[model samples]
Target chain A: MPPKPQNLKNPIIWFFASLIVLWAAPLFLPTFYVYLITEILIVSLFAVSTNVLLGFTGLLSFGQVAFFGSSAYAVSLLIKGTSLPFAASFFISVGMSALAALIIGLFCMRLRGFYFAILTLAFSQIFFVVVYKWTSLTGGDDGIVGIPKKPFLFFNINGPDAYYHFVLLVVMVSLALLYLIIRSPLGEVLQAIRDNSERTEFLGLQVRNYRLASFVIAGTFGGVAGALFAPFQGIVTPELLHWSHSAEPLMISLLGGMYFFFGPIAGAVIFVFIKEWITGFTEYWMFWYGLLLMLLIMYLPGGIMGFVSEHLKRGKDDSR
Target chain B: MEFSYFIYQLIIGLSYSMLLFLIASGLTIIFGLLNIPNFAHGALYMLGAYFTYFFLHSLPGVSFGIALVLAVVSVGLIGAFLEYVPLRKIYERSHALQLLMTFSFILILDDATKYFAGTDFLSIAIPKLMDGSITLPGDREMPVYSIFIIACGLVVAYLLWLGLYKTRLGKLVQAGTANKEMLSALGINVPRLFTLVFILGSVLAGLGGGLAGPLKAVSVGMGETVIITIFAIVIVGGVGSLKGAFIASILVGELNTFGVVFFPSFAMAFTYILVIVVLLTKPEGLFRTK
Candidate 1:
């Protein structure tokens, strides 16, 4: 019998190969396609942030957009209104989002399960209301427009290719950091907490603290994504802070199957492409989208990553 | 606001609470008996309202009372069909899957309404009997429909109490809630019981929506707006507990009414604030046990 391919034994190598493909795709794809890839990258980072809590710690947050929206608004305002450079505004945007997450996480991370989900949702709504009502600060429903793209250090990052590369670099760094966190001992503890929080607590782990740490980390990444997203989209609106926006990450995580490290990234790609395609056909996109979600949940609960892993396992068994 | 206006607001708030109570009580009972949190309850409510609108429109001179009865029954049957087909298979699965399935129903129902009813607000004409306004002692006039809604809520609440605490079916439902495995072990048909509970819940939601049709804009996305608020009330009241649902409904209703009066700009955020405060104080909710 033929020996099994070396790639079958190692999934990480496949992931790297996929990364190379993603990096090189922009070079060959059209400008419009490159913009779409940038969106996929940003959304992937957002999904990864959410997966940290959902897949690792069994926490489902419905207010993840609060961080994302707040950061976007903050960065957009700073870049548009002040004379601050792009680098400074970007850092400030991330810092503001992280700070907001820390404060909200302190109060929210105390609750468990459904209550936690509701709490986060409530907080996000509060953020939305504040942004919507505070016309002076957030520009109300019209949204903050005319946000100029910042130069990448000395180089102009305004062009589609330059913006794409900058976003690619940020996403790559974020994913690498996330991968490291997931492989560490801390990640094992988080998995244990998800499986059985009570047992983990009995084993002398600070479950609440660990969960909070994870929450803050997730929020920071989410905030970073939002900060990048504002410049990429060239506007920041209260809609970004809406509960529906939060659902995007949740749907992607579920679509990708949270159990796998790269599930959310794959889910983001499929989700964006499907959304783009479906919206082109009809205005009742939500109806079809809802149907798709139901199908995914019922038939492919493990998501695309789960599908791939199962296929690989089946192949191995067949060869044996 | 004047004292009379305050009284009027209170009445309106209580009447709104009545509709909320009917829908939420059904949800609470189903959650109690079947251990399934039906996320589609709001969608069912929206369907009920839309059906009432169409029925009233198609049949001129039909009394609001008869239209409401037809709406409730039709919605109840639809709810039963939903349970018999999809929900029945997932009863033994995880709550996560159950949530996903019902959540899917929201999309299907919302789009179906948009397709059939069109994406616009529809209103039912108030019946002739409820057209007149009653004069208060302070020379204030109030709509008779509001009073009618309050009476309906009280009657439904009393009937529900009797049904749950007094009837044999209620006892069986309570027993099922306590231990479904044990109830089934005793040879009770749990699946049929679940279907009954779901139908009954859907009927109540339909009734609420039918009643609310006159008071609020009967539109396609109405369910989406109210579902989150209803979920907050259920959570605040403690899931699966009728008494908790009742108290929380009133609490939320009053808060919303008063919050608007006091802080007009921040009124939308008030319900969420109440939810956060309630969760922080009692993580299991105000009345949840274990």
Candidate 2:
């Protein structure tokens, strides 16, 4: 991977600056587009959580959706069944997802490559089965709907505009923390494990423990995203827990660059738009989906963001 | 509860295991031989079921056996073309890329199948020869088709063994799988061998699909559904090991049938539980050939 550009005057400045633009985007654009952007934010969070495992930890997990869906269900159920406040339920749901992650990661951290991927997939399916069949608790296909929106601080979050802003606040804070972690020493160690596990192990570091920690953290973030999604959509179905649903972030991660921090965000934005555009023409979107994947893998391995960065780097080299 | 009931479940389980083994053996062996995880195997199986039904409907008077044979063979030919055309390009890529490439085929093939077959439950006709039920040693009546499927499993096992251990092409295949570069250097057409092995695997999957149509409802996404179980089977057995796949298939098949009878709701989860237990105990698999 090419070195990330440090051309900006200040990244924090650029971040908040772009966020301000995004904050104003809803005002000018149609109300429907604001709703779509909220969906994009949720998806980005999901994809970024996945990147914590894939890019940082070097584990290509196909089961992160297990955590994602479970968190969503937990929050939804808590709201419907109990009087737990939004913050309390969301925190509890996040922790719940992390605990599930810890158990799965305990078993999965031992395996490498395909073994890890397959094991995680099996674990995910177990959750899906439980949520689907345990109709009494999960409501199965009916799911838990009509989840009323709770107030965020002093502001009411009943409308789409308020919900969109609330989602932005939560996601932006979570992403900032995520960026900080990726820049930390533990983050460096995770990358080291990904690059060369044996060398890291030789340094007397416990590889499996680190993997478990990364897994838990990622799963917790995934949970937060899911928790937000449940109420945003006003329902939590078994479909959320399905393996295909898990593939969304995976596909987005592949579409955006894995190595780059914002790759998944870009991927998610493009993904939602493409689906909207393509579904307009044909119901059989799988062919086009496959073709796009093929083209990405064949020509632009780094994904759209990856390709753009590669081109930018080439331009720099030519100038130099 | 009764001895006869036990016998019946056992036979049913065995017959079901035979179906899984037919599909999984091909799936597992292909990974060993070609080092390619043919993700579209389930799609091919679905096609087999659909094609056999198509052939039967078109002919109107054709024997079920003949239609099944023709369908399996035709799917095999399609597999050959798939390998020669697109897959041959990506044989040397990373595992992730290889998986994505083959998975793409699932997307295309499944949609095409729906477009052609019109997504409905199609019942497979049980031919006259194997339509009757026979009494077992316990005086329990069993479907002759179940017995026929078991026989098919036995024949496939024997043929697989015979071909692998007793035939020249089999030796070439084994040699090719073991060391493709060395085999190529020895003036052997390694690419052709790879294509042949892929086709063979496709045929076995097709057979499984063709045979399974009579026993189960053929519907859309059957390919995706079965493929996950097949993955669990291979994972439990250990990928690239035919013997492991065989044993795992039997274990899973039994669990699948019995799990349904006992805990109908949790039946599907058994495969994953089995896989987790087996992996926790023995990471490679129960019988790790490697």
Candidate 3:
């Protein structure tokens, strides 16, 4: 008999299996669900980026959408005006976002807690207003529409299956890289800083450098998600840069449980599905959504993943 | 170039500052005492504006003074209800959860306003008695209503200061904030005090919104429109300090007035820049402890 298959309980094996499923999902699902899956993937990447600062570094940023929106516009502009391929445009978009994050992070990382959140929010709002007023380049309020998603180098990546596979590959690779970082010596130091910054400083670790590094990493991933999203949606709008939009991934991170590594992915799935389902029913979906969030906070402050973890631990205790 | 225009802008800015102070003082109080950042403070303001709009429009022969009083009291009741039900439980939860709940209230309140008031902008007509213009020494004429707003703000501030310093309830609240465990140990009903504070804060916010209705465009998203600026003011003023809120509101309002005149291009960005610079220099705020 063949050796027993790898245990599904292991997170690494589970993650790879989930990636395979994500890759194969479009072949069996309806077109609408496929679109939903794509949204989930994009938002998951965004949420993961948010979690890097929020969960890992204990920094709550309220302007993560700045990078996301900026990258979207950058990619859209490049694709619209230049002869660069999709891959090159994406690279350029992420690079531009990283540069922006570096500059903003210099000013922002100095402050912590509410001040940091507010500063980031102010920066994003400034970006939003500028984009809204800069009609010449950004198309202002009407936004840049009809962005073309070219076929990937030598692969017909226009169809849902192809795009889904491409996104799956990209997301898996990114996650793998993130996991490596988490398991690295730098990741250990970052965790230490999160638990006790004063102690970490006394230990001679550069707390600010670690924070800025995590911020840049988060920003680069946010830009990558934004670059993917522009082509997927075929539009890049000022709304993407709005503070309200920035709140989405933050909300997702909270709802999914920031403590877990894959918490944002779970959150992305729940958020997109809940939004899609609720909006289908009534225009007052926001009211109910808000009520649900209130309820969740009151009763389940640990979020969905945290709730699951508690139950799993209880189950193990009972079996023992 | 015009002297009267400068004075007019100054008064208008001060009036705007009064409204901001009324709302932001309550916000700062709630944040300081409860250690909960109430994002729904804006919703209470919106409710106040909506209530004033309906009261003034629907009721014939009712004075603006009476309508304003009714609007403040009613919005205060709604705020009390929110605190008693949803916010009361999450008092001990993480800041993230508190933020989420408040944020959810924003969505709920926005949609509720949309459902009731429709999506269009609603304007309140100023009372005929106060609608007339006052001629300034520099030959610049400004609305008499603005002067009334400034007077109202002063009256409210005086009352709040008196209540906080002189009243028995004020002593309890001060004691509670300083040492909640001790207050509870001494048999003070801490929860009741919190409820009272929440109501007072809510009413002030509502009053601010109601008074501002005539000046600003009152619409579905109007609460969110002013909230960011208010947050900036609160941060700059020092969170939880009433005096700080007052001073910060004036500072931000003056910045807005002058920012528009001197730097039209950067008018909107000025408040945020001020906040950033102040925060960098003094991260806790200009007046409060970290």
lDDT of each: 0.84, 0.85, 0.83
lDDT per residue (tens digit) for residues A181-234 in model 3: 765787777777777899999998889999999889888899888988998888
Off by over 4 Å in 2: A1-9, B136-140, B179-181
Top model by DockQ, which number? 3
Q: Show where candidate 3 strays beyond 4 Å.
A: A1-12, B58-61, B137-139, B175-182
Candidates in descending lDDT order:
2, 1, 3
B1-290 per-residue lDDT for model 3 (tens digits): 47777888899899888888888888887877777778788989999999998888778977787788889998999988888999899887656567767888898888988888888898888877889988888877789988988898889889988988899987777776666789889998888888989999999999999898887778878787677888887888787767778899999988898788987866878877887788778766787744
Tell me, what's the RMSD of every candidate? Answer: 3.4, 2.2, 4.0
TM-score of chain A of 1: 0.93
Query: Per-residue lDDT for A77-117 in model 2, tens only?
Result: 88889987787888899999999999889888888766677
lDDT of 1 at A160: 81
lDDT of 2 by residue, B118-189 (tens): 778888878788889998877889999999999999899889989888999988877766677888898988
lDDT of 3: 0.83
Q: Candidate 2 i-RMS (Å)?
A: 1.7
Pairs that clash in candidate 3:
none
DockQ of each: 0.59, 0.60, 0.65
